[model samples]
Target: MRDLYERAITAGGLHVTEGSKLWEAYREYEMAILTINDGNDEEKAKQVQRVRALFHRQLSVPLADIESTLAAYKSWEAEEGNTRDPDSQVDDVPPNVLSAYKKASEMYNARKQYEDELSVVAESEANKLQVFLKYIKFEKSFGDPARVQVLYERAVSELPVSSDLWMGYTSYLDRTLKVPAILKSVYHRATRNCTWVSDLWVHYLLSLERIRASEDELRHVFELAIQCSFPSMNEYLNIYLTRVDSLRRRMPTGLDFELIRQTFVDAAEFLSPQLGIEELLLLHAYWAKLECNIGKDIAAARGVWENALKKSGSVLEVWQHYISMEIERGHTHEARSLYKRCYSKKFAGSGSEAVCHAWIRFEREHGTLDDYDLAIKRSPLV
Candidate 1:
């Protein structure tokens, strides 16, 4: 039976590591075939149940079968979920030899051991900076601020410029202590050699706002962030707006908003493709948010949303807000069309399933009287 299973694995054209579930199912089917060949009905029945269970568990079932045994399981419906074609061809081996699974398992074990050994040797402060960072992350996740000080101090001393650690540490300060001086120091350290980091610059700007830094300080931070090339121009666009908004709030007549807004608009266009999908959406979203609220250019605000959607299709949050923006402008038909377009593209990946659900709820709760039907039609079950 095991020998037949080996032959069936190769015959199915499935690589062991690449399609482990399919390979396992092929092996089980081979066992079922052998039991039937030996005239053991009871054992064959058990094997059938096992094969059925395998089919139930997998989202991407293999198209072929064990030599000629493919027709026995037609009850299963295959969904094209999370499956990618193998990049390389399958390896062939003699039926008597089980080298594929053995070789792959051995290689995995060796790699795991190497990682474990390196982890053990990396127990020093410099090496375990990730651990301290992780602790800060845990605290952030739970919204707890107790160990933030300890984490921040140790992280700076051990891994001063590690952005993940520094960012995490500074975020704790922002959320818990709201200490302007600490935020300033963190920004300086975090961007010492790597200035293009948008989060670091933004946090620094925020800390400045809290501390009431002089216009000179604000402009300095702005220049430093812009010069660092750490963030795409699109990201810089939003950050620039944030600075403008803060300045306006603190001293409305002190600074020029139109000049800064123009600078950011040019920057966003220049930095469009260089940014990631999330950053790009945020850039335009913030632009639209700022402009629409301030009564600057309604057409430009709608245009910003349109450009963002074109770049990041089916980003539901953007779509929902874009829909809301259109509906607010009495463009109900446009909003309905946008909502449907977003709905059709929402099932992007399993990782974003939660985001998809949130978007559905957002649309349902905030959708206008005329748009609610289409919104509900597009929304999936939570």
Candidate 2:
């Protein structure tokens, strides 16, 4: 009964409490419903009689109190010739009822004020600071960097520490923004002080590279990023490898591949056992990329799949990527052999197994006969 009563109040967004006007009003309405439906059935009549008894037991004032209050209000109105008068005696509504009314009223007013402030902010684009903030929000939502430079130039003088503002402005400088002079400024101010926000440095580096950052600048960015705070070693590693794509032209004669190799060693050591599916797979892809780009070392590329297999032997995508890369390089034998290793491992179901079979077909279609024969030899059916 208590639970039912509580549920009723909760459903109406009211509280069951002493001196609650909402509860009192609801109780009156419920009692009136019983009064109207009292003769429906013998069972229902008894239930209504019980509800009437319970209502009076729970309520301090009787239904007559409401009637008396209403009659007094009518008499007072008749005498004063007005519905409301300061001198008229009226029953006080509960504080909870007034509080609920005030809260609803305030929420509506606050929403209006927020909308008005938003409109004023939008209209005050003549103000450079507001315009800069607008550009940051725009870039954040749409990623269109057209006005980044203009907004940055306008806002940077006043809002120097605003990272989003600076990011927008930096987006405008073209290749000039990537140079050591500019990068040094961003690193000194933003990355160094706020070591926890590693993405800021990563974004800044990418921004400069978008403007045509030199190989030296890319390397410098990586160095500084690693030196600052990398919240997760895998996160920093992925950032380093993603830039390797843009740094491809610089990798051979321009980039110090030896330095990259050392960094890879450091990252692998830090991340290998501690990695999850996404991070582990990304690490493998980075390894394949490094080998493909720098050393053209097939063994290095093969090692990525082998290491991934040791960790997550069931990940069909990892095997697929390895097979694809090998077939692309015309290493049919290696692709077949890896496929053999994958086939030996039992996956959970036929649906899971289908992906591996599809990749084998893809590899066979792309590679030589020596591959299929090797796969046949490794199979149990042979």
**Top model by TM-score, which number?**
2
lDDT of 1 by residue, 261-328 (tens): 67557667767767766666666666776666664677878888777767665556666668667767
lDDT for each of the candidates? 0.57, 0.56
The residue pairs that clash in candidate 2, if any, are: 174-211, 175-211
Off by over 4 Å in 2: 1-161, 175-183, 207-220, 230-234, 252-256, 348-352, 359-382
User: Per-residue lDDT tens digits of candidate 2, residues 83-198?
Assistant: 45434333242344334434544533433433344446654534545655654455345442322333344355445556655554444443344555655565556565455566
Candidate number of the best lDDT? 1
Q: How many Å off is the CA of 263 in candidate 1?
A: 4.2
RMSD list, candidates in order: 27.4, 24.4
